[model samples]
Target: MAVPEDWMGAPPRQPVDLHTDRPHAARVYDVLLGGKTNYPADREAAEQTLAALPNAGAIARQNRAFMQRAARHLVSEAGIRQFLDIGTGIPTSPNLHEIVQATAPQARVVYADNDPIVLAHSRALHTSHPHGRTAYIQADLCRPGEILRNPALREVSDNFEAKGSHVNARSKGEVLRFFHGLDLVDPGLTVVHRWRPDTVEVGAAGWSDADIPLYAGLGRTS
Candidate 1:
């Protein structure tokens, strides 16, 4: 089914700029999840990585489930109405906005990523419920102050960081520093699998708690 012009938002303010020959983390992740948004180089890189780590695909799925669980926790338990999700890869089903808005239709979400491919597909992520809102920012996380000060994040009450991001091989303490001033929620900075796993959502990629590759933390600005 084609999305009619009237249903879509305004065109992206900037043209999509990307290098198809280079393998990018965002695109590789898309390929791992069986998405068609990636280039041949991304698929090739993903295949090579999977060949090296046979469970790579499964771990990727688990990571995505972890994201959904975090969003669910924020909406159901924390009563958070706004969210800022960094390192947001290609928009996948049950995205942060989808998961949160399903329960709290007025939830507002901002997704930020440095990848050009992610920017290209950000339009899909911009769609929100009639009562909710969502936005995307193309940004590099190295500048923490920038993300914290971005206009889009001004209304964010809760900031969620899915740790163990490939670029982040830092010690746990170093990673926790990112949320220093904020108050952490229950099960603070724990492994993804340990954060109130929703079995129904994890499906076949339900790897052991110890096997989850990423760490997830939620913090409030209070």
Candidate 2:
């Protein structure tokens, strides 16, 4: 896919070094999703994890489904047009940008991940629509401040004119900070499954109010 024209002048391309010797979380996820972008070590690690917990793949899928639904809600109902998604895994169909842009073509998205493989594929796969904007940054979740401060990432947040349209980070501290300056939607800062549980079983199996690996909620910036 061709790079979007808007992103063409954004920044210089960073070198991506594919480390195939060890297992990476993004590659493991790709293997679980049956994508062809993983190494042998990743497949081996993923198989071991699956053996230990059969529900691992289901959990990943559920997380992804939650992300899609959340992005859609932010765009369609909440009227958010800017997103900062960190720990973004491999480029899957209906990515964050795709979901939001589909609902509102003016939506802007900034995807960040530490994995080199994800960076490479994201560079190729995350093209924006003519009017919308999409950009990727190779960064780690541990450095939330750095990611938020990135020039490319800041551009998306800077463009938001509405209260809820600015960049919202996806970590525990960041999520809290985001909500501190904003009003969370009803049923605030819950686990993914708790946001809109599909079934009783899903709710029972996935609810974790204390320490959910993923924290998601919609809020209007104030």
Model 2 local distance difference test score:
0.74
Q: List the residue pairs that clash in candidate 2.
A: none
| Global Cα lDDT for candidate 1 | 0.74
* Candidate 2 total steric clashes: 0
lDDT of 2 by residue, 65-138 (tens): 77887777788887888888887888888789888988899888888888768878888777888889888887
Off by over 4 Å in 2: 1-14, 154-182, 198-216
Candidate 1 stretches with Cα past 4 Å from truth are 1-12, 152-184, 200-210
- For each candidate in the order shown, give its overall lDDT on alpha carbons: 0.74, 0.74
Backbone clash pairs for candidate 1 read none
Candidate 1: tens digits of C-alpha lDDT, residues 147-179? 776655554444544333234445667667767
TM per candidate: 0.75, 0.73
